[model samples]
Target: MEDNYLTMDLLRFTTAGSVDDGKSTLIGRLLYDSKSIFEDQMEAIEKASKQKGEENVNLALLTDGLRAEREQGITIDVAYRYFATPKRKFIIADTPGHIEYTRNMVTGASTANLAIILVDARNGIVEQTRRHSFIASLLGIDHIVYCVNKMDLVNYSQQTFSSIKEELKTFSSKLRTKDISFIPISALKGDNVVNRGKNMEWYEGSTLLHTLENIHIASDRNLIDCRFPVQYVIRPQNDKFHDYRGYAGRIEGGVFKKGDQVMVLPSGFSSKIKSIDTFNGEIEEAYSPMSVALTLEDDIDISRGDMIVRKNNSPSPEQNIDVMLCWLSTTPLQPGGKYAIKHTSKDARCMIKNILYKVDINTLHRIEEDKKIEANDIARVSLRITQPLFIDSYSSNKATGSIIIIDEATNNTVGAGMII
Candidate 1:
């Protein structure tokens, strides 16, 4: 029998909230109620809960894997957990909620299809909630869920959930995000997390798990603009059938198939697709997010960082690009600062030419007077690169429109930017 896991769809989502908002507990509850937790893991959590003198098992311990995290009672780093259900496989990124960890939330939300913003019913909405929601929208997440957690603390009041939901709707309107939903739950009590408990009788909606499995994410990918960034040039020196050369990389956008005429960037070389090679065999067609090695009918001087696209539909090349940058380092971003820019597989040097404005994440206002960008600051800036980059607007195609900045001296990623 064929394994069902092979065909199951995968979903990547992140959980963001303030400290002690039950982000970890909600993830733990999902794992526990869905029967994804192992016997040994459950035993350890049970023992730990008893050691801490808790009446109920501390489900947060399941995601707080680090010893320091458990000791401090906070999430200091991004913790990723994997679990599978009958319908879908899920990868959960439990991001830290503190203001200092804003960069971590950006990193976690970068690749997520949906974001769950947990709000404490007792506290209503706070600054951290707005901060995370803004960052999630800025990262281009399509779906957002306002999970009103700890409902038991507020007596499972419908008024509390309704009020919080309305506040969230009003706040999110200023951002680019559109799809938002509300769910009331008590993560500690496992109410309406994975299973619908009897506590909330007024709330009518699918459980969190059901919503996750049913959300239509297949349309999230860009299937119109063909973009293939060649990462490697493959050659076989062996004499078995020695004349084999292939360009290997992931398809970032659109569809690519054998015999399709494609053009290479910068070089303006044109070639027809010969075959799509895989470990198993040659594939007939490939689309966005598929990794394959393509052999061209005509061999041209193609190397890493060269992009392939349809001749009629190509990305614009620019040497001076405007971008919205999220500073990730402790050092403030200075104008004229030089850094290493990595866009797709292309790497080059760039200098910050101008700082247009800094965004006050709380208010979504552009602060033009204070152009200095500090750690976890988001700003719109202009950059001049040594070479031209083939790119698109982030709204058009995320895979081809994003860039990361690396500190030249420290060799660390200091910023992430999206082309405007």
Candidate 2:
């Protein structure tokens, strides 16, 4: 039992689709059927359902937490929920489905291991479906599950499911997804959600809960290139360990072991890893996403935003970058606009060199003539930074390849870009 507990991994996934596609309901059903919700929460939902004159308890209300969202019956911001099964722990990012909130969807999916693009069976394929699918592909989501929701509304017709599946396949051929699966589900009726519903007699695939528990996500992490961005310098003031000096940060890629030779970026200083220290004790090795302090064999000047990486396989440091920019601010992104660029632990000023093209999400067309980018618009742009940043392509490593643009005066994150 202890070994099984130790080995159970966590899966992070995001849901995206058009408005009223049952994205929230699917998540609520999963939580309710898995017994992850509290008794008081269930009673509260029942009370809300009564107030709304609902004959049955509304599961969708479970994730629509904000009063505005519950009153409006729409998800305006991203809702996150956590639960655990015997096989795996899960994190769900329930994103808004409206076209206007495309930037919210991108923020939720940035760290997801997989994406679930929901579609209403009655609606078949719509424009929003294409838009969300394109965003998923652009974000480098390798695994996609097209859940044809509201199967009950369509009378659980296999013919309808088949037709929608075919249409999605034809549309998604233009994407760069590696794997896509189709599952017909009725989020309201609990069909193929946590348990298989009797209405779908022809479907032979595993339930959604089972797939979430069993999907392989171990290969999602980049474990070949070592990149550790130092976030803090640890120096215990006065103690028996007075000479102790360590660099603390979360490892973004590859495996780092004790005694391994490493180099500090910007300074080009080399040293050997003396120890990997964690809260409990010293660890033999550490990998991506693990937060630990590392002591070096030699005393070196390393500060925040400085990266420690393997000498042979190091990230390229460059000042000019080509990126796919997702504009999130109301202010239009124009050529020569200046903003603060935040990449990992580094902060630098950058000027927009050029706007290559704005993409039409529905058709995936590059509108080269549109040099101005407004809210929720995605475009390819070039940027010139004041300092060289050690980076990689977003496809090569998401942790080191992404950046956020902040308005200098207001200090608001106005844009997110994936380095190309």
Candidate No. with top TM-score: 1
Tens-place lDDT digits, model 1, residues 14-77: 9998888988899999999999999999999999999999999998899875646454643236
Error in Å for residue 42 of model 1: 1.0
lDDT of each: 0.90, 0.90
Q: Total clashing residue pairs per candidate?
A: 0, 0
| Residue 323, model 1: Cα distance from true site in angstroms | 1.1
- Which lDDT value does model 2 have at 25? 84
Clashes of 1: 0
